[model samples]
Target: MPTEPEPQRPPVGPAPARHELDAERLRAALVRGADPDAFYRRLDVVTETASTNADLLAAARDPGTDRRVLLAEFQHGGRGRHSRGWAGVPRAQVIVSVLLRMPGIDLADLGWLPLLAGTATVDAIRSVTGVDAELKWPNDVLVGGRKVAGILAEVAGTHPEPVVVVGIGLNVSLTEDELPVPTATSLALAGATDLDRTALAEALLRELARRWQQWYVAGWDVTGPAAAYRERCGTLGRRVRAVLPGDTELHGVAADIDEQGRIVITPDDGGEPIAVSAGDITHLRPVP
Candidate 1:
């Protein structure tokens, strides 16, 4: 018999600074719920993985495995939309990935999954920590205009076999020094003391499961998430600049996100609302 070739793995990025978080205890806490199976099939914990998204995608593709969630105390190679690199202190953040089998959903709709997850995550953080967390369009969550969390959604399995994996990384107790960018912030620094990573993770998972069911069952209605997202979205009604897919720039007032999850903007040059599917947005000034 010929020798089998080894599997190829994604490149490993910089590791998050190590810290202590008891993944076992967190898993136990999660499984105690009456509907544990609804939220997480099996809470697979790892000290470090290249990325939880990558791990969950792998699990979703396993021959005999059902959809599962991956909870990691540390991720050596976490990535965001557009393949942006993000790192954190191990155990100082909440990094989780939920594997979903949504066979009926169109591939185009997958782009909105990140926003759906963002809306749920913001709700959970607000409920548990009593702090104001805001969404910065598409997939970034901010606290007082500083990035506190991010989401990345990936789809695996093709045609007859389709799966969606939504990954989330939150700065639970990350310090000032760990922030890779000047505008990034953390819950602890925002006066969200008494950090409880376990409870927060459970809350996040529960919220995600609830919202995901709502979206999936409701045919991915962006109305619900868009409504909630708008309430906490810092960009809405703000003068902003958007970098479109073609690298062109447009200055406008972010009016709202439509029912289909498009960024609805009214241009400063007086055209009708422009619906954008992809872009990087920056606040220009307060809406006048």
Candidate 2:
């Protein structure tokens, strides 16, 4: 009897490429052809952190600490506005915090910091990934009405000088199953061809530095920033329901954003427009 023929093996394809972010590569990209003293005094990249904001806040207590940046690959205890827990898969997001000491900046103008951050994020995402990212009021960065990034601004210290810690978390390569929520999205899900973390990070920091300089030089004037923000904000002119702090909800049409960076909503029942400083806004579609 003839021996049985050996079974054939299936063809092998190329291995999936893994993209990793390097601390030194990011630092070099951030400082290349830029003024380090004027922008980042020190840049640090950590493997994991509970919260970059918390870490920077602690560092802010020392008055001698200069403007520093902290980037985390994974955050076990990261948080957003209202202390909401925020986290993403390791090496699949941009988790960074910027610590700045504003010596004579007025407290009132500080409200625009989050908006400034949101605008910078939007610009960076658009330029890097070609995604039309927009702002969802205060600090949520949305792409096609889905949240892709979030910003949190916290006051770190106030004695010698006011130190502000602004943290941004952007989803880069998360797949559908990896999204934090149904309403959340990532650059990969949003059809971004390029997911280069180093390029994206450099673009974000460059835009932030440019906008921050303008805002700082203008003494935190919201005229320019507000206009730019309004243009990129998708919440305005849409019907929305704002969930206030006390569990009360306000349903109205988002009319405009005030100078103070508050959302001005005109009630559907002919009531006076309400300026909401802080709240969660949900866009409501109109009935046919």
TM-score of each: 0.86, 0.90
> lDDT tens digits, residues 105-179, model 2?
777878888899899999999999999999999889988778899999999877766789999999988776777
Q: In model 1, what is the error at residue 49, expressed in angstroms?
A: 1.3
lDDT of 1: 0.77
User: Cα deviation in Å at residue 102, candidate 2?
Assistant: 1.5
**Candidate 2 Cα outliers beyond 4 Å, as residue runs:** 1-18, 32-38
Clash pairs (backbone) in predicted model 1: none
Model 1 alpha-carbon drift over 4 Å, by segment: 1-25, 28-37
What is candidate 1's CA lDDT for residue 10? 24
lDDT of 1 at 43: 74
Q: Please provide, for model 1 over 187-276, each residue's C-alpha lDDT reduced to its tens digit, 9 standing for 90 to 100.
A: 777778547877787788788878778877888666676777778788888787899988998888899888767789999889998998
